[model samples]
Target: MRKSPLWIASFLLLLLVQTSGLWAQSAKKASYRNNNEVRTVQGCEYEVLKGLAEITEVEKTRSKSESALGYDEYSVKFKFTPMEKGQQLMADFGENSFDFFLRSGYDRLPVGPKYLKHYYVHKGQKFAMEFLQTDDKTCREQYTYKSMGIPNDLFEAQDSIKAYKIQIAAEKLYKKEKEVNEAKGIAMAEDAATQASGNRPPETAPEEQPKEEEGPKEEEPLDEEDPKEEEPEVDLNLPSEEELRKKVEAELREKEGLKKSPDEMDLDALRAQIEKEERAKAKAEAAKQAELDQKNAIKREKQAAKERKKLEEQRRKEIKAKEEELRDELAEKLAAEKAALEARKAAIREQVTNEIRRESCVYDEKISGTIKVISVEEGPTEVESLFGYKEYVVTLKFKPDNYADLPRKERKLWDKTFTFKLDPKGKSANPGATYVRIHKLFKGNKYNGFAQRLSSGVCNDIMVYSPDLPIDASQVRK
Candidate 1:
């Protein structure tokens, strides 16, 4: 009977489950100590360190290229027997941690399509194992063992239970497959016997007829009893052994003649030709891929350069804008300083004009000498403008040069010249008074004198001045 689709699917699923379980069991028991094996093999002694295992008795052999990943992997068969029976060393290291795959036998289950060719294990008669180094502490890897030489530390302490477990598992699988094959063979034999018996003729006579008997019994066909027809003629033109030998010998002669030619090949020559072709194919593929990669790299570089240039331009524009702004700000500041300077100059001019205008002249026509007034007291002239002017005393100032001409004795006298000022509406000054009384306050003191006698003929002479000096009203500037 044909198998149902459902049954086939169930069988496949069952097989997957069993196979996964087996691999899982093996993986769980695959751990080994890197520093545990310190035994000597051949004539060489090896030391093992933590995460670095060393095995002796390593035999050199040709590397095989038929690994799952299509790469050549090196193998060193053991010279000394393994420490644990039925347990073999399979090196597996990666990242920082070094590991050894503890296998029951040399032949190991391939991991998967991805990792199968990349990492593999092989069985050997008697071999030592060691880990030279690892790619990292956390990745799977392997290193050159014989090339790196051996490490120090003969052995390390570790549990051996795991190694035993793997050995037991491998044995179980091997026995199970053997049993299955034997059982299949027995079942096939029984099937063949049953088929043979069913084809045999009856040995006894027929039973008594029933009430509703069948019509006449059918007789066997005569053709079945006839002897088999003679077999048809067969083609037998195949060459005899001697003819084949002669043909082979001729072919060998032709090959020998070709070898004698300059262009012909020997064993090594034929091997070199195969390797050269392989290398050429590999190089061509690599060159094509490299060209494609170069194009991609150039594209990326151009993009990066464009971006950099764009950034540089933006920075330059920003810097230029800032420079212009600074220039504008500096111009505004200078303009403000210039305006302030002009205002200060104008203020100085106004101050000088006020000082010049405040000076009053005190002239003595008797001696035709004139002196600038230092102080004034007015009771004569009176005038008012812009609000009512009040009577007041006014003080004037003189430079050092003006007093230097006076004699020492004359300098002691308070005043020798006088000028008066008045406002009409001011009660302090009487505009109607004919004789105006004036007072001189000099050197912070009061004095009165006539102006004519005080104006001595010589500018530095000491002289007496009559009291109650009078001055012309027109002499004062309006």
Candidate 2:
């Protein structure tokens, strides 16, 4: 029993399909097993673990398709060892020794090299590591500072903490300063009250002298009859007690009246009146000044308006003059153009009249001759015919049979060779033909059934007839 080639090929394809399906199932089971193992170690609860760790190694894992997934399926794995002795982390993932992985599309982790350089530069110092585990059993690794316990670089965290402390200290200092100022104000107010009280006059009355002893001591006796006993000693220079008492009463009244006497009150009233008068005078002066300023302003405004009007009038005149000048120039230009046009029309009329006269003459005249020479020539390449057709120059020299009977001007033309342009495809003279008849010869005439002149000073449409052909005598006779 021999196997056919087709059967072998089909068998191989079936085997391949079976093997691929088994392989896919095995891969899926392996991935699920790995996920289960990871989940067992890292519980399915949102948590973050932080520790100081040294980066031992970095690795790139196999890349998966990203078409179905929005983000890159490639991952970068990091392996690190805890700095503290006897410290163990559940983040250690399987035999690969990777603590966590970061989803990245780059061949090399973008931030890994820079972070490693910083670590080595700081004398192989350990970095603060953070492992984040979400409820979905996904794990991510990031660098952090232990003090902040947040996912931020060490330097950035330090700066932020320092700025926050500074701000807090500034606020505290401001509050303290405000409290101290308030205390100072209270102390100043208390001191001011104390000083005011100490400076006030005492309100208590003077104490009376003790009564004089009733028994007098032994006197030295009576030298001057005791001038003190005769009458109360009186000093004429000093005011009497009664007078002093009245003066004191008057001073008390003045003090009770806020220290102003009647005369001083009158002086104050006089000063107030003077101030009022001065104020009224100043007000009047101000009013006069304001009125003057208003008048001046009005005058200036009127002057400005007048100037504006004058300028407007002058501008209008100038515009009018310019308009008139332009109109005159336009009229002159139109006149010149009209004169040129008229002259051109007159020239065209004269040319048409001359052409008609020549045509009439040619209609009545007749000439026949034997062709002495006939030749064809290529026309000028640069100059095309008016009808946009290809043309050739044909030269004909003829000896007319009636040369002696023709007029002097006609005879002169008959002696000369006639050269003209003609469309080879249209009605034209042929070079191989012999006898030719010409009914007209003119300088400036269009092609009819006779000779016609072209703008190039050549003749066209000169009718040719062989000698055997019958002549129409009525058409050719004078």
Off by over 4 Å in 1: 1-267, 347-478
Look at candidate 2 and tell me the lDDT of residue 82: 45
Question: Can you tell me which runs of candidate 2 are displaced by over 4 Å?
Answer: 1-290, 351-478
The sequence of per-residue lDDT tens digits that candidate 1 reaches over residues 1-478 is 7645544555565557555543443322122344444422221223322222332223222232333323222333223223443333334321232222222222222122222223332333222444233322222222323312222211220233344344445455556656766888999999998998876776998787778867998988666644667767988999999999988877897988642544654869778999999999999999999999999999999999999999999999999999999999988998988886777567556544533442322234432222343543443223331112323344422222334687877555535433233311111121222332233333344333323332322121222122332333332222
Q: Estimate candidate 2's alpha-carbon lDDT, on a 0 to 1 scale.
A: 0.46
TM-score of 2: 0.22
- Candidate 1: residue 228 Cα off by (Å): 20
Top-scoring candidate (lDDT): 2
- The number of clashing residue pairs in each candidate reads 25, 0
User: What TM-score does each of the candidates earn?
Assistant: 0.22, 0.22
